[model samples]
Target: MSGRKTGALLVLVLLALLGACSPAPECSSHQDCPPGQLCLSNRCQPGSPADGAADAGADPGRDAGADPGSDGADAGADPAGDAGADAGADAGADTGADPGADAAGDTGADAGDEAADSGPGDCLDPDGDGYGTGTSCLGPDCAPDDAERHPGAPELCNGLDDDCDGVPDQGGVCPQANPYLWVFLLAGQSNMVGLGVNSELGGADASGVNNVHIFCDLSVHNDGNPHCLHWVTPLVPGFGVLPDRFGPELSFGRRLHELWPNRSLAIIKIAEGGTALADRWAARDGDLYQLLVQQVTTQMNDLHIAWSPRLVAFVWMQGESDACSSDTANAYYLNLRNFIQALRQDLGVDLLPITAGLIADQPMWPEAGKVRDATSLLADHLGPMDVVETTDLPRHPDDLAHYDTAGQLELGRRFAEAVNALLADRDWEFPGDFSRAQGDGFWRYQACQGASCSLLSWDLFRRYWKNASATVLIGDGWVQPAESQAAEISWWAPWDGRIQVTASAVLAASGGDGTMVSIFRNERLLAGPRPLTAGSGASFDLLLDVEQGQRLRFITDSGSTADGELDRTTWQITVHMSRVAGD
Candidate 1:
């Protein structure tokens, strides 16, 4: 036990003291702890109360030793209180026991994972408008309750955005402005029924023009045709009473389709043969006029089912029968006016333009000229009326009254020209020089036995020409003019010019010595003081210089016969005026 023995003993004592002062082994799990011990604050400690207190002071990582009466873990809360609170108290407080700390920590980690699993930006949407509520989600809805109040929806006339494009009712999805079909009404007599043979022109194919439609009033035929009272499309040859015949409508519709290829064009045609304006086709009730109205409205309703219809114009081509009788011819102008007015009223289009086709003159119809004159007067009376001359159109080979196929084709093209002029708001100029004098400066006169010579104005003349009597006597006795046999007419010159004024009169006498007929302008002699015998007719023309606003007058004189028998003589007179060239 010298120096070496003493050094070894000292070393052993120091090692023992160091071991006693050292910290307990740390653990993160129960498996990391010794047998019968628990892991707490990453350290292995005793499970029993006595052992727990003994080891608590033995490990400096824990608090100083607790008294036997106090709980060992609670006593460890004194020194290093925060450490004890976090490790011992808090762990136990979280799990209700120290052993349950790991379970509590694992439960907290599971809760965090659950919160992460649920989408962070996912928002609650109470309303199902394809858009979400709350600021946290994509496609945030401005209004959640209204389905129509969403984005990218159609905007309607309603105050809201139906199409949900930021702007309302102004974009591509907005309602169309004018969704209407342009409509035309074709009505009149045999000409309107289209007597031109369809085979002559090889017919037209309206089927190729998909937008043009037509509804013919076959009810007037009373033939039990299926399309009689219904609307039909693609106007073709069989529209008239005769299957081989067609009217101006075929070409007219084709031209219209060419003009408006994108829009729907509908034509409602109601016409019949031998219809006179004075009787069956008169504007008054109980006539074919009401039937025309009914047909038009019925077709309009049918058209409206697919698209709204706008009545653009009315085309009238008739008057042949009216020209057969002098009475009807005389009343033609007034009858036409009434018909147009009534038509406008019934159709609810006050300014509806009427394109009338003047009846052609026929040798069989002597009074046809009178009807033509009345039509001219009709044009003068109505502002929106236009007259298309058919006198120059070639007549059918078999029939003298109706137009031939080529003429009918031209007539249809003319009708289209007129319609286009009207729709384009352009002025329509008539074909000849007579068009300038249409409103005035033309007159027709007839005088009969025992009747006072009547000085009728244009309007009056058209109404009462037939009732005014005039008998033409053509053989050998002495004859005299009717009482007050002279009639006169006057008109103001529209421009300063030399106008060619012409007057013609047909005279008849029964064995008259002679009769003197005369014509004058502004009380100055212009024509005849010419003397003639029985059964004579003559014409006179004068070129006279006239100033603007100057008035001209026409006069006729017939001398007395030996017997004073005025009934034996009568006369008819016609006067025409035209502006001279280089005026």
Candidate 2:
């Protein structure tokens, strides 16, 4: 064989070896690779012209050669001046992640990389809200700089769309921390749910009673299992069993709104028509009572966090089912008591105010005498409770068990009145007929007419009253029963100066809302209507300016709700009339 033929044979063998070692094509187009990656030599690569989208807004002109891998961002003002990084290697989309690379330019920026875990990522999550912006690392965060705005975030009452749901403030009002916004719970059986026709009760509530929010889950049937009837709405007429039917919550909520027009109201009404206190609402696990607490827990999750709303009242209109049988009716009192006890325990409100309605002695549930008696006797002068007389309220003529339009409406009003009475009874006040002049100042007691005090003597104040010395051993004030209007007990300023009045009062029984104790300088109102719930006494601490003979009055008043017979309060007002600077 010739030497030339032998050399050519060797060349052919080397070409065959190189062809066998070559890799397969990795990508075909820009779409075939990650955002920052490009198709170079049929392989998905980065930092080259193929990865143009990732290099957007970057200076493309090349200058100084750079290191292979760079953890630094935007090394210089100009892309070419980036001697710290490789040629045209942008913080935007170019880096050298490959182990082996030449110093001429960066291999590429990882399209889906967190750049040294600082300042760079597949997405520009600067706010760290798990969202970002930019063409290479596009994200759901419309406001990339803000951490609060994102998908599925809770919509705040702020002007922005916190949840990224297009519209802002969709989840309800923001900073729902208004203490005056009272929440009431309405529960019970068929009568409580009500079967009155909407047409018979004035159709739909088109005007939408203001500030009254309702969350109802009455979809459950006689089986007593809770249903997923999740929805929150402004108070409408047809929130009954059917969309066309009306219930007690309508008038109950409305009456409350009317009575306390200045403040807002809300309700959590969970009921079933045929449930029995002894069975369905047994206060045990997996029952209607559990459903009530569970649903309410979820519903009020935001409310409790935001507004710190109070559960002011619980109105119950039930007992027809238990009344159907003598055994249940006989055990009604104990069972009912246990139910209330369990509710208060679960809700963590031991001093919960309740308005229980008497079961009607209608033909539908004729053996209701025991149940009726139990309801009435639950609050035997041990207040924070009131009873609505349902036995007298008219029932549906045909059904004999359910309340007709008028009956249902009246029932609701009565429930509201009963609740009002209970709350009013806790409002403490100074007695007008009881007072004395001691030392250089006169300690006088009076009832507040509306919000102001003209110093009128009421029969209630005259009948149930005690002087400050008799009420509290340390203070010079008055002890009197709470009435519809707030009561005032003022002390004449012995000398002109700034004084601190530390006043406090206590209702003999539980259940209270609103400013129990407040202070005023002469006729000018000063600090507080300090709200105190439960057995905790209401108190006030105020530093006020007073004239030499000005009236520094300590006032206590329940809102307007006529019956406050049970609001017997002990009063104490200590005035530190003499104080040095900073003392």
Candidate 3:
């Protein structure tokens, strides 16, 4: 047969097949059909190939055995038409098409609809913690059980990272109240009340001056006493009673302000002149103590109202009046302890850091030695306590007792140092060499003759004990020890370091017996046992490495029983210990 005739016959057969198999119009492409119809296998379909086949097969004219508009297919025809319709519907649904659509459409809502039906893992955050749990979702929450535990949560001190930013307690606990500032409590007597002449502070320069706010409530005293419970920038002369006097607060506030420029400094000064710890500043019974507590509470409330502040430390500098009497001086330790405990109780914090200045030596006050002893005892026994020494500080020429302007300035600097050390959790040590003059003067001593030892206080030895066998007396700038007696002085080592100890004294033996002077480190002999004879002077210089908390002992032993003696003429005994090196 010819090629043209064969092609015409094939086209006629295809047209016949289309007319019988499909009820839709016949076309070469999809554009030839109605607006929504698509051409498939030369048939104009309503949707796609699968949709047209299903609809065409459902017609009773095309399938003789099948009912019109019925879902069932003809018995003799392939069952794939119904299967193809089911597959097309599933594909449309999986691809985010409307379920009612005949075939898979171009809409992207299928996955979203499935996620909405499944719940939680979708973009929906049920916990409201700004995080989602599903792997396919936008925000994946690692821990959905705890609402507090989420991405970008705040880290607190409760041993948990509330905001899951991969750090635990990074920023510390958030303050419950705002306007947080640092507070300092200034208490005690005269020196604390600005006994120093204000004119002396002319040369002292405080770097950051504007950050300090002092709250003074001298209402208990006369109106002229700078009594106001309002915040004011600290000024030298105004901080005290008279405009010409100033206390340690000026330098203290200035230094603190300089150290923490970003933080606000608040000083609550509650001090008065000539107040003794036994009476005026007594913990429970004293009027001043009660008044101090009241003022602190009232001012603290006012401070909170104005600007919330955190109470950091308490600075105390009293006890001069106690130095005037033996009874008050003796009880200074207990009185100071009670006052501190009461202050902490009133403030509601038991472990408040207390930095106190030791009472300076008063030539007119005979019992000053006792007060000094009590102050040392307090520093040694109390926790979170620091003592700044003022024994060597020069007194103001005018008052003859109060610290001079230079002394007050130095005292204020020391107070700041001690407070700063407390905040940093470190020890504050007095610089320079420590010297104990008069042998039995600055130290507590116990003398023994053949295992019988008696503790001789610093005051008693200065008063009596010239004839006793174990008596050691300091007179005319000399130390005199009787026969067969050993005098020992012990103190706590301030720092861990190598110390150079030097001791010198003139000695004389009654029956030609030699005398020996020794230095011991916690009972272990480090230097001395140097022999002494009549008209011979004993002297020893030794270097020893020591640690803090170690006890050091300096002892003088008369070698012969009832026969040896130390000369009183040119007989000064001095023990000086200086830190040479180490830390």
Off by over 4 Å in 1: 1-178, 203-208, 219-227, 426-583
Total colliding residue pairs, candidate 2: 7
Best by TM-score: 3
Worst 10 residues of 2 by lDDT: 101-110
lDDT tens readout by residue for model 2, 263-306: 66788888888889888888764288998888777876767554
TM-scores, each model vs. reference: 0.44, 0.45, 0.46
- RMSD (CA, Å), candidate 1 to true, equals 44.5
Ranking by lDDT: 2, 3, 1
Q: State in Å the error of residue 48, model 1.
A: 83
Look at candidate 1 and tell me the lDDT of residue 33.
61
lDDT of every predicted structure (CA atoms): 0.52, 0.54, 0.54
Q: Cα deviation of 121 in candidate 3 (Å)?
A: 23
lDDT (Cα, tens digit) per residue for candidate 3, span 1-583:
8999999999999999987876677764344677667555456655743343233222211212322112222121111111221122222211111121111101101011112343533343323333444442335433332233355543333222335553333463423324556788998777787766655555444222677788765534436555345667754346666656667888888878766667777888887777788988888789888888888778777776766455668998887789888888889889888888777766654446788887777677788778877877776555567788987887777677777777777787889988877664222211111122211112334565543555554344444333343356433334455665565554433323344444555564345465665554433333445556676665444333333334445566655553423333222333233431111
